[model samples]
Every structure is written in C-alpha cells, then in structure tokens.
Target: MSTFDYAITRTLDAPADKVWQAWTIADDYGKWASAEEVVLDVRPGGAWSSVMVLPDGTRIPLSGSYVEVVENKRLVMGMDVPGRDEPVLMNLELAADGEATKITLSQTFDTAEDRDQAEQGSNFLLDSLTAHLAA
Candidate 1:
C-alpha cells in the first residue's frame, strides 16, 4: 500500500470473464462505469477515455491508458484526472469466489486529497457495476 492509495473489494455474482467484458467493452461499460460516453481500447498501452455525465448534464472528461491488461484476471490503467499533475494508477484484480467473482480495486494517487476524492467516485462506479452485473 502506497501513501496515497485506497482499495475496495466487491463480490459480484458473475464470472470473471463477464466482469472483464463489462469493464472493457465500450457499450457494456456505458451501462455502468459511471460514464455516459466511453471509449475504451482494452489492449495494453491502448487509449481509454470517458465523459461522466452529471444529473445537471455536466460532463467530466477522463483520459487514460491501459498500463497492464490480463484478460479475465487483472487490469491496470493510468488515469488522468483534472487538477492532478500525474496520472493515478488503478489496479483491478479479479478472482473466482465460487459462483461469484471477487473484484479488488486499488488506486494510487499523488496526494491524500486526490485519493479521497477518487475513492468516492470509485465506490459509485463499483456500485453501478454491481447493478449492471445483476441485471
């Protein structure tokens, strides 16, 4: 655990492959991921961007790239947020938990404030993912 890092774990009632698809595929990602418009190139070093639309129609743009990608197992990405000088590194790990999949999400930021702010959004995004997977 780094100085400015946070981890969240969730058990989703879906296979790892399905969860991976939800995270990587553009259309599937739009259903969750807390973004209205999403562009994802899931391969290593590929481009990743999305616009999260607020209820008031405000769009917050996020850009990033896949630092490491392991299909159905793990994904690590460098995510750029506004006001951050460096990209935040996000690691998502998936493993089998009987009929469900266990997802552990970790994010490393430059400062504690940045990490705390990002943590809120991460929780919302994962909650969205949980609903999407159940549906």
Candidate 2:
C-alpha cells in the first residue's frame, strides 16, 4: 500500500492556546468540524470519534486514536476513515505568530486520489474553523 501526503497551512487570527482548545475541546471542535457528534479524549493513546452528516444527510463515521499530544503545540493521530483498509496518519502543528496562531495540518493517504479528495474537505474544515473563531 503506497502512501501519499497532503498538507494545508493557515494562520488564524487567534492565539495558539485558543486554537489548540478549539481543536482539542469537543464542543469547540464540533462547532467547526461539520460533525453531528464529537467525542475526544485528548491524550496519547486516547480515543476520538465523530459522525459527520453530509449535505444530503449521509452520515459518515470517523474514529481515531491519539498517537502523540503536546499541549498548544502538536498533535498526531491515526484516523480510521470509511472505505479505507488502514488508518491515516494526521499530524497537526501549531505555532504562535504574534497574537495569532499558525496551523499546519498534514495527512498521509493511500493514494493521490485520496489526497486530492481530502484536500477539498480539509480546506472546508479550515474555512469553517476560521468562521467559528470569528464568531
């Protein structure tokens, strides 16, 4: 099984701590994650899950386990996506940029098609996060 990588970076207008909370805290995560339900245990070896309801009402279930966690700095997880034989490695890094936060999200996928498909959804997630922060 060959793997490919996809990454997206965004500088958010919120502090690193706040951005970290928005991601680690279940409530804040659900606000921008486009998921109907969210469960997060933010520690190494902890578990997380979410059910995302699509625009047409299709529900997709996603689950993962934390591989590494660094408060306000970095997080690494293995995400179990539907129709995939293996979990994808997702790495998130946060850095303080003045009063704001710079986030770099990278995901490893099984194929270039998978990487391309995820790029759109990942962008939407970031856009949603930006809006959620502004609110």
Candidate No. with top TM-score:
2
Per-candidate TM-scores read 0.91, 0.92
Q: How many angstroms is residue 34 displaced in model 2 relative to the true structure, after the best TM-score fit?
A: 1.5
Instruction: Give, for candidate 1, the lowest lDDT window spanning 10 residues.
Output: 80-89
RMSD of each: 2.0, 1.6
| Candidate 1: tens digits of C-alpha lDDT, residues 1-135 | 558889999999998989999999999998786686689999998999998886678888888999999999999999876777877789999998877999999987767987898899889889889999988
Question: Which candidate wins on lDDT?
Answer: 2
lDDT of 2 at 44: 97
Look at candidate 2 and give me any clashing residue pairs: none
Give me the displacement of residue 5 in model 2, in angstroms.
1.3
